[model samples]
Target: MTATGLTPSTQGAPDPASQAAARPTAHHPARAPGRLARSVRRNLTAHGFLIGAVVCFALFSWYPMVREFLLAFQKTERGRTTWVGLDNLTTVVNDPAFWQAWRNTLLFTALALVLGFAVPFVTALVINEFRHGQGYLRLLVYLPVMLPPVASVLLFKYLYDPGYGLLNELLRLLHLPEQQWLQDPDLAMLSVVVAATWMNMGGATLIYLAALQGIPGELYEAAELDGAGLLRKIWHVTIPQTRLILTLMLLMQVIATMQVFVEPFLLTGGAGPEGSTTTVVHLIYQYAFSFNNYGAAAALGLLLLVLLAGFSAAYVRLSRTEEA
Candidate 1:
């Protein structure tokens, strides 16, 4: 033995741990180039998809918005485009139909809130209360939404016909007055609202029903134990539980109702009797297509965009504040 008490063979041998530490790992250096290439390929693929989406948005959405903004400031005359500054805005504001359209639009929104908003929620509540045939009920409610919008609107048109319409027939059977449904100036807007509600309420009803189903049964049980009736339970338990969804739906409904076009356009020919059902969107359509005033149309659209954006911002802020 040597002075250190080690055999000669052991003294020459290196420790396994030290040899391992000195050795190059299988995953390092040799595999690094392959790993780097794979990483680069993956990153490139992701970037390619992102770029395609950006290009699409730029082409379809952002481009149109920018074009509209530019068009709103410029006027075209005899195929010559000239920057008119706020002249387009002035023209839009000065149009006689401007105030009337705004009024009608506001009226439609209010009426829609009352009917379109309430009807769906009520329908959802009724459907939810039923333990059987819920699926069939939901299907029935959503059937209108599934039909083509034009078909649905045309169906309403036939129903609202002053003569020989099923509704008027039913009224006659009941010995009630057979009134002009769409022809009457006073009833024209209401008729359009009813048509819109029926056409659109299906989706909202389904959403509300889903929200209702998500509410814990224990909460309803608690409400019952507190001697709450149907309305009371809905007010205290249902509304609170689904407040967020309800608010969201309300905002969407308001935005949609404000921009109503197809129903009134198809049903009442855009401007109903005595211009009673003329909406902001209808006015925009008139400016763009009927009058061939692109600048005016863009200006009006810009105003609508601004109004909706401001309203959405306020709603979001208010909701956040309430949550806080």
Candidate 2:
């Protein structure tokens, strides 16, 4: 539009058509920051706790994991870090002791799970059926868990004493040949497994007991009406109802058993009887501290981590499937 609000030809004499052709002047009020400022403040306050938590997680958990990975790929000598590619992992993989430790750990895990898992469930079922002294039985089962691992392992060490150990003495009294519990390599893992099973059964027992109580009484009543035997009722009703919990506990037990450290560390004093009781965590300790090879230790730790993650993923999938 021209100054006179008309085109050049109609400038002098205003053309009604040209004036009508001019575009409308558009107005937009400038925005105030009040609403935006309030929104920013609300977001800042709401996420303040979350931001702090994330920072702490990064500073501690994430940083340590990443550092361990870096250390796994690099070797350190006299305060100097040198990139060694997969040398650390290769050394760990090539070590002859690795296979033995793996075997021992797996054996311990299988035995522990078999004994530990079933003991609690059976105990829970029996005790749940009982009419009296339930509290005392639960207390007895949990009592060992309250004892310090060192104390408990040490106590078992006394009991496993070949010469005067109560266990051997009992066997001797029963007209049975005495067997070395902790001394013999053939029995050392078994001995530790028994002790670990005893010490750890409490937690699983408590969880299963709680789950058992949560089971609906109607199921049992219906099974009774159907003339189902005790075993059949357990197989059909109890097992299915508690299957999720049993599966979860099984996976958790696997993870915890894989990281068997304190028990063997104290019981066998770092891998028992020619490393027959050596576990993966114990080996990692020996590598990182005893041999002072942080790289190999870190590499082995990363391997253990991968194994745990795989187990956990499978557990999650199985759990979700059970839910579905």
Candidate 3:
């Protein structure tokens, strides 16, 4: 009925779909603000947590390191602080105990690697072979790690007592001559290493156990099919599979053993018979608290820090190269 040859009502009226599409959407402005507020609150909360962590690290860790670096160059005497440059380093180097401490520390590190490093891996391997009671075994192995460190050290001290100690009693019962465990200078460092290994190997054992569990069974089976013995399988399959973890553990063990303190400090009173157990950290303790030479302590600590940092850097670089 119109110029287009359609009904007038159809021609004049708007399409329902077009009107629906063209009309402005009914947005809930309240919802938009609510969402924005929630997002801002979340961001603020996350940032607050991040800021708290950063502040804590800055206050506790970074500030102390910076202070130590500054203290290494400055000396406090008679309530007056003066910059003494390399005097602290010279003093620490000149101390008679310095070389002795370094020697003892290196010896302890070697001993610990032989005992502490190998014992845990062997224990883990043994435990991993068990088909049952794995959880109980793990708990038993980790029990020592759960004990308070001071309590454990005291316990070892009691056990090391030459007179009527359990270890001495066992030796006597077995018709073996009872040796002075901690009294003799030759035995003192070895006794301390033993105690240290017993105290710390629990954690390492669990870590190795976890690494061993992650190795696929197929490799072991293939190794068995190749007529490999237990030792051979361990060497070829197990070691390769856990090579990364072993490398990491080796580095950690070296670092930890080099910083040996608590065991020697508790077992032999920081300086064992004839200064045999005098470690680098023990020397630092002597310098700071015993000798009241904070500058010397800081200088010694800086040397240790640099040595450890350099070793860690080298280790990381080597690991990266191996991975590549």
> What is each predicted model's overall lDDT from 0 to 1?
0.95, 0.90, 0.94
Instruction: Tell me the RMSD of model 3 versus the true structure.
Output: 3.2
lDDT of prediction 2: 0.90
Candidate 1: global Cα-lDDT? 0.95
State every prediction's TM-score relative to the real structure: 0.89, 0.82, 0.91
Model 1 segments beyond 4 Å from truth? Answer: 1-48
lDDT of 3 by residue, 74-116 (tens): 9999999999999999999999999999999999999999999
Residue range 1-324, candidate 1, lDDT tens digits: 566666355866899999999998787446678898999999999999999999999999999999999999999999999999999999999999999999999999999999999999999999999989999999999999999999998899889998978899999999999989898999999999999999999999999999999999999999999999989999999999999999999999999999999999999999999999999999999999999999999999999999999999999999999999
Residue-wise C-alpha lDDT for candidate 2, range 137-253, written one tens digit per residue: 999989999998888988999899999899999998999999887778999888888899898889899899999989899999999999999999999999999988898899889
* TM-score between model 3 and native: 0.91
Which scores greater on TM-score, model 1 or model 3?
Answer: 3
Against the true structure, candidate 1 reaches a TM-score of 0.89
